[model samples]
Target: MLADELQHKIDFKTKPLGALGHLEYLAHQIGMVQNTVSPELSNPHMVVFAADHGIAASGVSAYPQEVTYQMVMNFLGGGAAINVFCRQHNIAIKIVDAGVNFDFPAGLELMDKKVRKSSRNILEEPAMTSEEYRQALENGKSVVSEIAKTGCNIMGFGEMGIGNTSASSLMMSRLFDLPIVSCIGRGTGLNDTQLLHKIRILSEAIEKYPHIETADEIAETFGGLEIVQMMGAMKEAYDQNMLIMVDGFIASIAVAAVWKKDPQILNNCIFCHVSDENAHQTLLELLGQKALLNLNLRLGEGTGCALAYPLIQSAVNFLNEMSSFEDAHVSNKE
Candidate 1:
């Protein structure tokens, strides 16, 4: 049930019990999950799920909802920054139409998992119906399963939607019992008046909808197709004992959803980075995630995850390569 081989490798090659600090610990965790000291990080995949939110029309985000559609086009054309970075890092990127409102043209490997054309107006009502929420959950699980079948155990998730930060802020405020002031931020460059309006819109959303008592209730009301899908994917990864890397703020919200269902899911996650978003810290703290990086990055297209892969690889690499005082014939410290 434990990683004896990893312990053997660590004890045989490394310094003292943990001279390598967190790297030693990280290697141990990876080795245990992978069941080998000679563990390999196979096929790292990043799934950038695109969706449209009705809240965008209300001026929640500085950018228009059309950006989501246009961004997806950029992703398909390999013109996005994430695409370029992923290519440089050798991380395969897959773009999915989780619930982009636009009828994306054919040819991309688009998954048919759209819940609705788009989410309901958050100003008027909860985002999605309970049935739609369940469907989103299933679709998320299905995506992870597809990746697992492809021998990809380690996966990362990201999202693209204009008003999603507003939704995430609302979710953070409600889910963590934090004040809107602590969670809301100037998403996509909101001006002073627009920032104030964002705070007000989110505050009103909370007052109108109130707290969500269950996971399904939360996802049903506040979840996007992309967000809930990441939740389901993470749940599936946890169930299967695979490693799941979380991207930026919106991707991190999926982990919060997973915790909303089962708090123990944090064991399977390696939070890749901290974000500039104000609520991101609170959400990560609530999940008890001491994320691997504090890059102040708010770019939410698996960029953090891509940036984190080499760090993880380094941890694992050093674990298996670094020699002990005995092996190197060096003096040991007391």
Candidate 2:
């Protein structure tokens, strides 16, 4: 698993040595994980978990609560960007309705693990009960375990929830010891006044919850439904050595939560992008991850992870396909 021979093979590729930069590094990492000099990357999966946040009542987001179900309907109707991009990359997409506060039609592929009708109002108390938080975490982990048993070696986790950004903002502020102002952003396009109000609301939520260090405590205090579940999924995925392609913003926040619980998971995870959200850069800085893209996208539908798929695929492709100079009978670099 040292990947030394693999590195040598990569170095001898017919292109200028190391010309591929991080792509080469990425390929090497994949090969080491597979314990193969030439690794085959396959069964890419994009799992988008949708839920609702009661904290939206506090005016944290620019979007209304109705957008949550409306977007899920769009996703199932194949009208969302994730649907389009997943088709382009040949990646199977799974949409999990982890804890949506709505009536999902029967017999759809919707997952119905409703932790509660909705998260608790954070203005007055913890966002979720401790048991609900643990259950959501287990639900998330079990979901990933099911996917892994089916031979998915690489997983992209994205989320959907109205007002989740507020939950994430509070979580980040606490986990990273950053000011509430630094953790909060203009989620879904709030004006300065609205952003300030959002910050105050999250600050109040954090202040209301008492000091706690465990993952469940952290989640119960400030986490939204899908966010905590996604954190559990990430931990399970890393334990399985499945590559974690993190989506932007809220998705990254969940990833950050996993990191707070266990930093070693970072080795198997890849940060996908820097979201348009101002808080994302600071969160990424706290995680010490430089994302692959900076497209300034603030959408939370796994669009960033879907777009980064090709680059990841190309890295493994070059590792397995590109010929060595000796094999190609080509001149070596001077």
C-alpha RMSD for every candidate: 2.1, 1.5
Query: Using lDDT as the measure, which candidate wins?
Result: 2
- Candidate 2 lDDT over residue span 203-295, tens digit each: 777777667766667778888989988998999998998889999889888877778768888888778889998889887887878888889
Q: What are the lDDT scores of the predictions, listed in order? A: 0.81, 0.85
Q: Which one is best on TM-score?
A: 2
Task: Tell me which residue pairs clash in candidate 2.
Answer: none
Please, what are the lDDT tens digits per residue for candidate 1 over residues 1-334?
3677677677666366666676666788788777777666878888888888888888888887889989989988999878987898888888877788898777776676788877888889889987888888898898888888878778888888888888787777677777878988877878899999988887877788765666667666776778887788789988877888888888888788778778777776888998888778877777877788888888798889888888888877877678766888877656
In model 1, the clashing pairs are none
RMSD of 1: 2.1
TM-score for each model: 0.93, 0.96
